[model samples]
Structures are given as C-alpha cells and as structure tokens.
Target: MNDALPREIHAVLIPVGSVRLLLPNAIVAEIAPLSGLEKVERAPAWLLGRMPWRDDTIPLVSFSLLTDANAQEDVRTARVAVLKTLADDDEMPHIGLLAHGLPRLITITPDLLVRTDGGERLARGTSAHVLVRSDQAIIPDLHWIEARIAQALPA
Candidate 1:
C-alpha cells in the first residue's frame, strides 16, 4: 500500500443517483435549487440549458448526463452547482453543474482512495486515483470539462 497520506479535500458531495461525488471546494462557487433555465435550440443533448447567474448568463450541464449516467427524472428536485472556471486572459465564468439531490460537505480519508487501473474508460473518465466512500468518488478532470466548454462556447 502507498504510504502517502491522503490530503484532506474540502469537498461538496453532490449526490447523483446512488453515488455521491466529492468536488473540490475551490471549483465550487455556489449551489442553487432547480430553477428557470432558458433552453438553447440545437444545443448538445448533454447541455441542460442556460440560466442567469450573478451578472452574466451561464450554461448548465447535467452531471449525470456529462458522465453518461441515467437521466434525472426529478428535475424539480435537482440542484445546480456553480463552478468557477478561468476564461480568456484571467476572467472567471460561473458554469453550472446539474446534479440530483443536494450538496454536503465532507472530509475524505487516505484509506478511502484507490489508484485507477490503466485501461478503457468512460465519458468523464477519472484520473489515476479516486476517492471512495460508500460509493466511488472519482476525482474529476476540470481541464477536460473546460475543454468541452471551450469547444462549445465562444470567447
């Protein structure tokens, strides 16, 4: 077993289906209950829609949808996690992550993590290591998420 102690990640546990995801606190800006979102025509299926946030409107994507998990049946009960992402130069945009249920703050222990195996992966594929609790908590690749937004949105 690796002797390295796990760094405690102050994360927000966003429940999606039976799984609870530990998202880095730094990335999370705010969490809001499901609300009005302006649907974009011809947008990707994964894109939930757009909503007014702070000053500018932000695009939202279902976390389950992004991971290719089951589509949420209770959109009314779902919540949106606003994530701060660096844009052109040094601007930060608040992008929303649509997830089922609510968010909880938790501490992750070293023993609860495992190194990922080298092989085929899924959409939103995790890194070489993941933090697990009652369910597997894959450490997300923000760069991957950012790239997806870059491909879809204009500067």
Candidate 2:
C-alpha cells in the first residue's frame, strides 16, 4: 500500500452558470431552494439580495455575475447554497450563493487535481482555476467574498 499518498478531500462541485465552483464540503452548510430574496437598494449587481434561512437572513450573491459583469442572473432551477463564512464575526456569519443547479459531491485526490491556466486575469472571488478529473472548476476565495459581503451589507 502507498502510505505516502495524500488523503482524499471530499468536495462539492456547485454549478453557478457556465462554470462550476469547487469547494470543500465542510464549508457548505445547506442547499436550499431559491426563494424570498429581498432586493437591496444601492447594492452592486453581483449582490443578488438577501434570503431567509433558519432564524436569520443571509446575503445571497451571484457568483457568475461577480466573475463576469455581463453574465445574466438565471433564476430558473436556481438554488441557494448556504455557506459558513470563514470569518469569525457574528454580524455576518454565513452567506448564500445563487447556484444554477444542485451541487455534485466529488472526492479530490492530489493526483486527480490539476492547476490550469484560467486566463491572463483570474475572475473576482476566484482563487484558482483547476481541473478535477474531467471537470473544470474554480476554487473560490471565501475570505475575499466574505469581506465584500460584509462591506455591502447596510450598516
């Protein structure tokens, strides 16, 4: 047996628009149906709005719009991925992402993951473009996203 082989990482492939977001399963709190998004005035287009979840209302964002300004917000068959924020602040402990479809669970091994050249400029909210097996996905910058969300929220 190869004892030195890297352990496998259980992850999720979340469909945003044309691209997929590769994220660890731990950060994903829940996958809920898209509903009751209260639009916020003077907010950026990328900030979809706010959605009700449990006893709290969390900000929802369109990953596609964040990366590409021209990307349209497709609501048909849309779902909200409630993600646990990386930060320890209580004001914004969780944020939601508008997903085009249900996320698929994937097991990631070091050998199966490959770094790919996304382009001359990587999109906002994305840390790296990678290919997991045959699927091409982007690793999201959760900290950056959380900061942006925190700034956007009305103080």
Candidate 3:
C-alpha cells in the first residue's frame, strides 16, 4: 500500500517599504530587478505602472502607495516580485508588486504564524497582519489586489 506524502505550505516574505508582504510561494513567478515601465495616465499613485515580462506585459502594483495615500516613491532601490494573478483571467494573467528588497522563502506552519494587531485596522487587500516568529508581516489578499488591478487597467 502507498501512503500520501504530507503537504507543506511555503511562502515568500517580500519587503515593500517598511512592511513585509506575505505571499504564497506558488503564486510568485520570479523576482526581478526593478525596471522602467509604461505609466498609466490618470491612474492613482498606488498603481505604479506596467512592466514587460516574458512574451507578455504585467502591471506593477505599488504596495507602498496602497497602504499610505501619501506616497513618496523611491523605485531606484526597489525590486519587482512578479506574481500570478489569482483572478483566472487570460487577459491579465500576471501582475507585479514593487518590493523594496529581495524576498525570503519560508515554510509556513501553524506554529510560525500568529495574528497580530497591525493588520486588523487596515483596509482591504491585506488578508492579515501576522507575526511570523514574532516578526511583523502583512499577508496580502492576492485575489483582492488582482481584482483591483483588473478594474484599474487602462480602458
């Protein structure tokens, strides 16, 4: 008789501004150095722009600008974490997040994740602000963010 292997959940902790964005590792396509993008006219500051990747173009969402309406963007030192859209739309399959630093891969388990007060009062797009081994981190709502991105796409 064969037994099924135990499943393990992995996530990446991406640094964006002063916060750490927690995202499931499976959703992340690749971590690339920040590059120039085509700006979306009339878009909010939170909507950074669109960056080209592979054979397709992916829009970059500014995590910093989203959290704080007052955004002072400093992209010169940032990186981009290309993510697979959870929206399941072929028109926009991928999106990028402006990450401040390199992402760190970590194993996610019950013992490591603990709910904290940081994210409780924040608005949507954040699943929760948790303490991973006592270090504060924000769990991003990929679906929610992706949905917003879809709406913000230039018509």
Q: What total of clashing residue pairs does each candidate reach?
A: 0, 0, 0
In candidate 1, the residue pairs with backbone N, CA or C atoms under 3 Å apart (3 or more residues apart, or in different chains) clash, namely none
The TM-score that candidate 1 achieves is 0.76
Q: Look at candidate 2 and give me any clashing residue pairs.
A: none
Query: Model 1, range 10-31, lDDT digits (tens) per residue?
Result: 7777775555666778778988
lDDT of 3 by residue, 1-155 (tens): 76964355788899988889888899999998777688998777788888888898889989878767776778988889999888778899899899887899988787778888643476667788898886789888777788788788876
**CA displacement after TM-score superposition, residue 140 of candidate 3 (Å):** 1.2
Question: Tens-digit lDDT track for model 2 on 36-110?
Answer: 889988899999889899999999998888778799987878999999999898988889999987899999999
Candidate 3, residue 26: CA error in Å?
0.4
TM-score, ranked from best to worst: 2, 3, 1
Which runs of model 2 end up more than 4 angstroms from their true locations? Answer: 1-6, 118-120
Q: Which candidate is the best by lDDT?
A: 2
lDDT of 3 at 121: 71
Q: Against the true structure, whose TM-score is highest?
A: 2
Clashing pairs in 3: none
